[model samples]
Target: MVFELRPASSADLCFARELTRETMLRYYIQHDLRWQDEAFDVAWAGRENWLICQGDSVLGFLSLSRDAKALYIRELHVIKTDRCKGAGSWAIEQVFSMAREERRSSLRLTVFKNNPAQVLYQRMGLSVVGEEDCFLRMERMCSAAP
Candidate 1:
C-alpha cells in the first residue's frame, strides 16, 4: 500500500497522544518506569511530528528530533489495526530520507529491550550502540544507499 505523511498539527494532538500512551504504556510498566502523562506534549513541542496516512486514513505518528550527531527518532507508534502493513518500515525510511537531505550522519533511537520493534530497527540497519538500564540505544550511519 502507498503511504504518505503530513506534519502533525495541534488538532492532531489528541489522536497522537492517545496512540502513544495506549501503545507504550505496557513497556513502561514492564520495565518499572514511570509513564508521564505529559511526555507526549513535551516531546511534541520540540520534535518534528508527522501523521502517517494511507489516503485519508491516519495510521499512526512518529516524532523526530536532531542532536549534533544524528537525527533522533523520539517516538514511533502505529495503530494496532495497521501494525503489520509496512507503516513502520515506511516511517523509518522517511527518517532515513530526511537524514540524507539534512546531511545528518546517522539515525538514532532508544527502544525498550523487550519491545519487538527493536527487531524492525535492526532490520532497517540500525544497530545497538549503547544500553541504558532498560532501553537499547540504536544507530544507523547515513549511507548513500539505504
Candidate 2:
C-alpha cells in the first residue's frame, strides 16, 4: 500500500492524542514505564506533526523536528490493526528524506528499550547511541550518496 503524509492540524488533535495513547500504552505497561496523558500535548504543538494516511484512511502519525545537529523523531505511532504492514517503515523513510532535505547530518529518536520497534529502527540503519533507564537513543547518519 502507498503511504502518504499530510500536515496535521488542530482539527486532528484528538485523533492524534488517542492514537498515541493507545499505541504506546502496551509498551509502557510491559516496560513498567510511567505515562501521562498530557505528554502528547508537546508533540501536538512544537513539532511538525504529520498524519500518515493510506488514501482516505488515517493509519498513524509522526512528529519530527530539526536542529543544527540532527532531525529528531519525537513520536511515531500506528494503529494496532495496521502494525507490521510497512506503515512505520514508510514513515521513517519520510523522516530520512526530511533530514536529507534539511541538510541534517543524522536522524535521531528514542524508543523504549524493550519495545520491539527497536528492531525495526536498527533494520532501518539507526544504531543505539545511548541508553537511559527506560529508553534507547538511536541515530542514523545520512549518507553522502544522495
Candidate 3:
C-alpha cells in the first residue's frame, strides 16, 4: 500500500494517542518508565510532530526537534501490524529528505538498545555515537556524496 504523510491535526488526537501507546508497547514494553502519556502530550502540543496516514488510518508518526545544525528524531512509532513493511523506513527517509533539504549537517536519534529497529537504523547509515542507560544514541552525517 502507498503511504502518504500529512500534518497531524487536533482531530487525530484520539487515534494518535492509541497508536502511539500501542506502538510503544509493542517495542518498548520492557522499558522502565511509562512514556505513552508523556509522548501523547508532546505529540499533541509540539509543532514538529507528524502523522503518517495511509488511507483513513494513521500508519505511524514521528516527532522531531531541529536546530541550525542538526535534526533529531525525538520519537518514531509505527503500528505493530505495520512492522517490516517499509513504513518506518519511509518515515525515516522522509525525515532525511527534509533534513537534507534544510541543509542540516546531521541527524540524530535515540533508540532502545534492545529494539530490533537498531538494525534498520544502521542499515539506513546511522552509526552509534554514544549510549546512555538503555538508549543507543545514533547520528547520521549528511554530506553531499561526490
**In what order do the candidates fall by TM-score, top score first?**
1, 2, 3
Q: Against the hidden true structure, what lDDT does model 2 obtain? A: 0.89
Model 2 misplaced regions, further than 4 Å: 30-32, 144-146
Give me the candidate number with maximum TM-score.
1
Model 1 scores a TM of 0.95
Query: For residues 24-138, could you state the per-residue lDDT of candidate 3 as single tens digits?
Result: 6645558676665766676567658788878887778877888888889987788888778888888888888888878889989988888788899999989999998888999
In candidate 2, list every pair of residues with a backbone clash.
none
**Across residues 1-146, which tens digit of lDDT does each residue of candidate 1 receive?**
99998999988888988998899889888988887768768878888899999999999999999977689999899999999899999999999999987888999999998999999999999999999999999999995444
Query: lDDT-based ranking, best first?
Result: 1, 2, 3
Error of 2 at 10 (Å): 0.9
Better of 1 and 3 by TM-score: 1
Q: For candidate 2, what is the TM-score? A: 0.92
Model 2 Cα displacement at 111 (Å)?
A: 0.4
The lDDT values for all models are 0.90, 0.89, 0.80
Error of 2 at 121 (Å): 0.6
Q: What TM-score does structure 3 among the candidates reach?
A: 0.84
| Model 3 segments more than 4 A misplaced | 26-29, 36-39, 144-146
Task: Name the candidate, 1 or 2, with the larger TM-score value.
Answer: 1
